[model samples]
Target: MLRIGVLVSGGGTNLQAIIDAISNGKITNAEIVTVVGSRPGIYALERAKLNNIPSIVISRKAFNSLEEHDTAVCEHMKYCDVDLIVMAGYLSIVGDKLINEFNNKIINIHPSLIPSFCGPGFYGLKVHEAALERGVKITGATVHIVNEVCDGGPILLQKAVEVKPGDTPEVLQKRVMEEAEWEILPKAIDLIANGKI
Candidate 1:
């Protein structure tokens, strides 16, 4: 079984999806061992609690430097014996120590197709806004390897949702999020479970 660890920074919609998928046997040979959040007072922790999963809140505010924060987080992961790291809306720019330790064992789901609307400052609703502004007919999600750079990883899977004629960022995002991301994330997790990752 793959011992999975999830990192989140905000409301854990994706995290909930993964948990639901695992419970329903949509993904086999995997279990979430721990859930870590970069900050406190988010729905992610509550979700973990509801599911009876162990969770931790590592405050970056408590650490003076990025290296210190990374050390603290990685230490927790090591303690839990996590085999894989999944970034489910984790906001921090992961530093080198964690990347080096996990390497290709880490996976992240981006809100855009990547190599298009991805970078340090692009995330959440901004990605959808950019895609609509660019007049792209289709914009969706991509699950990829987590590299040192933000969203600059080799693609694993992508699913596109067509941009409707009268779509706003809000509408398009809701559609894509419902039709694409909810399924793609689980598919990515299954790939890892079956030695495809």
Candidate 2:
């Protein structure tokens, strides 16, 4: 089976989606071998433990320099023999070292449609807030190859979630995340695992 690693920084809802996909046989020919987090208290890591998967905590504050931190994450991926690195709510910006090492093997899920409300200073609730403020008729999630720049990689898959009337940022966000992520992220992973990418 193709071994994969996941990096998470928050609640791991995306991680859970992947797990559900795997359990439901949506992603064939692969399994998530390891999971790493920047902090200890995250539910993502806890979920990994419950599944008996190997997990690690690499703190951004532990390293004296950014390069060191990147190196540490890269080393962990290498140690796990990770064939692919999935970024699910992972907050830290990966350095060029790790990006270069993984190349197109690393993938990320962004909350908003790229080339729109993306790049630095945009994540999670921030993306939803910006989408609501801009009055975008449609907004959703994107799964793409990870590169040195934030959300700058080539798009592998995208699904648009329509903006409904009287939608608060929170409500719109929940709807979009549910509609887009469960479909797109698994499809991207399956494509890569099947050598279709």
Candidate 3:
């Protein structure tokens, strides 16, 4: 089975989605071997613990620089024998060291379609806020390989989520997650695990 190492920062709804996919056999060729959280108290840790998956806390404040922090994360992922690093709402910007080590092996599920409400400074509800402010009729999510460039990688999958009227950033964010991110992320993982990506 493929050993997946997930990195998270916040609520970890995306992590839950992947767990569910595995449980339901939507993805059967792999398992979440390890989970890493950037902060201490994030719900992602609880999700990993509940599933009996090994988890680690790599606090950003513990390191002197971003490279130091990513080096630590990279080392841990290596130690875990992670075949694929999945960034499930993981907010930390990975350093070139990790990117170079993983190459196209790392993937991220961004909240919005690439080249639109994505890239640097575009995360969480901020992407939805930009989509709402711009009055875009459609917004969605993207699962792509992680590279040095923010949200700049070969797109693996994408699905459109409609921008409904009177939608708050939070509401749109949830809709996109449920409608697009949740679905395609696991599908992408399955594809990668099956050597279909």
Task: Go through the candidates in order and give each one's C-alpha lDDT.
Answer: 0.90, 0.90, 0.94
| Steric clash count of candidate 1 | 0
TM-score of 3: 0.99
lDDT of 2 by residue, 1-197 (tens): 77899999988888888888888989988899999998889999988988788899999999999999999999999988999999988998899989999998899999888988999999988999999899999998999899877899999999999999899988987897799987888888888888888
Number of the candidate with higher TM-score, 1 or 2: 2
Q: Across residues 14-82, which tens digit of lDDT does each residue of candidate 3 receive?
A: 999999999999997999999999999999899999999999999989999999998999999999999
Query: What are the C-alpha RMSDs, in order, of all predicted structures?
Result: 1.0, 0.9, 0.6
| Candidate 2 TM-score, C-alpha based | 0.97
Candidate 1: 10-residue stretch with minimal lDDT = 173-182
- By lDDT, the candidates rank as 3, 2, 1
For residues 29-106, what per-residue lDDT tens digits would candidate 1 score against the true structure? 999999999888999999999999999999888899999999898888889999999999899878888999888988
Error of 3 at 147 (Å): 0.7
Q: What lDDT does model 1 reach?
A: 0.90
Best by TM-score: 3
Off by over 4 Å in 1: none
Per-prediction TM-score, please? 0.97, 0.97, 0.99
Q: Candidate 1: give the clashing pairs.
A: none
The worst-scoring run of ten residues by lDDT in candidate 3 lies at 111-120
